[model samples]
Target: MTEPIRISRTGSVETWTINRPESGNAITGKDVIAAFEAAAEGANADIAVRAVILTGEGKIFSAGGNVKEMADRQGMFGLDPIEQRWAYVDGIQRIPRALGRLEVPIIAAVNGAAVGAGCDLAMMCDIRIASERASFAESFVALGLIPGDGGSWFLQRAIGYERAAEMTFTGDRIDAPTALAWGLVSRVVPHDELVSTATELAERIAQNPSHSLRMAKRLLLESRTGTLESTLAMAAAMQPLAHADAEHQQRIARWRSS
Candidate 1:
């Protein structure tokens, strides 16, 4: 069987593509855990990989979780359930947290529809770049499910509580331009240029000192919940470590000589 996720590397960037195009890249139960593990391992292992780009094959970025699989599990476990639901939630949470925890940057290249968990998947990335064809929706409410992934956490953070509440409650789809206007996406390009534009952005990030980028990502992620004074203290502690790195010294010397 083919891998549900395809991973490729170019210089300091790793691109992860959701491979189930026929089903609009819908993730299966197994795919969710596997993809998360793979991404986390990649981030941990490769010091050279400074950024990650997430995209999907063919038309749709993702249609979210496999509806058929959900139906099948529902049939097996019955209607009123708890254990199975929690298991599914656990799997969903793992993927997004893994993506968010990665020290390097993550950029989502949304080529088409990113519905339900798919939308959360993109939101989990540090930056999102969408194609003109892209559309987003929380979608879980329509399916009689809550956002099982880190959707609740990230959505509120991304667009604020009111907007996130509105989207989650109504389950209405938002177009690329609307997403950009709402600050949900960094940029929107023509469908044809989506991949190229994301690659260019990733390449730019890749050119920076990898250690500095990782440390900066760490600080930004940590700052979300901490007090300003605490965050400042954290930064103060990190600055000397960054300055002491050989990469930082070399760059500083080059700047001085120039």
Candidate 2:
């Protein structure tokens, strides 16, 4: 059987596919969550891996939590309400937390349907690029549930509060064009070109100074919750490190030549 996530490396970029195409790439079990967490941790430790691409096998990106599992009251939906609460904390929630700590930037090459937790997964990435065939929905409410995997936080940040609220309340799906209009994804590509486009973008990003990329990503995330003064102070602190990095000289040389 295939793994829950198929991981492959090409030079400075690594691609991770949510491989459960049979279930629309839903977070079917602990294996999916664990592997995702492991991948983030591994990427964090590996300095050579500067960027990551997350997509899914088959047509669908991810259906979020498995609705069948939810209906059957299995997996995270196992046992009672109290059990489910801790399950979120211990299970699906781990993905965002692990990813938040990742030093490398992630590009979500959303391939197809991204519903419920699936949508939230894309939101967690540093950058998002969608295929023309891709669709996103904060669809937890349709199941009489809320985004248990932190979609509320990530979604609003991606497209602001009002738009995010509308999507969450109605559990409505928006197509790639609509998503681009709302500033959710940076760009949309032909379905066939999604991977190639994303690879080009990721490689371009990876070619930059590694230390600066990580530092810049951290600053961007922190600034989301930080005040202007604090953000500036943090940036001040990090600037020295970036300047001191060995890549800085090579970058300056390349810049001067250009």
List TM-scores for all candidates, in order: 0.94, 0.96
| lDDT for each residue of candidate 2 in 107-222, tens digit (9 for 90 to 100) | 99999999999999999999999999999999988879888888999999999999999999999999999999999999999999999999999999899878899999999999
Candidate 1 versus truth, CA RMSD in Å, comes to: 1.7
The regions of model 2 sitting more than 4 angstroms off are: 253-258
Off by over 4 Å in 1: 74-80
Clashing pairs in 2: none
lDDT scores in order: 0.86, 0.92
- Provide C-alpha RMSD values for all models, in order: 1.7, 1.3
Distance from true position, residue 214, model 2, in Å?
0.5
Candidate number achieving the greatest lDDT relative to the actual structure: 2
**Candidate 2 lDDT:** 0.92
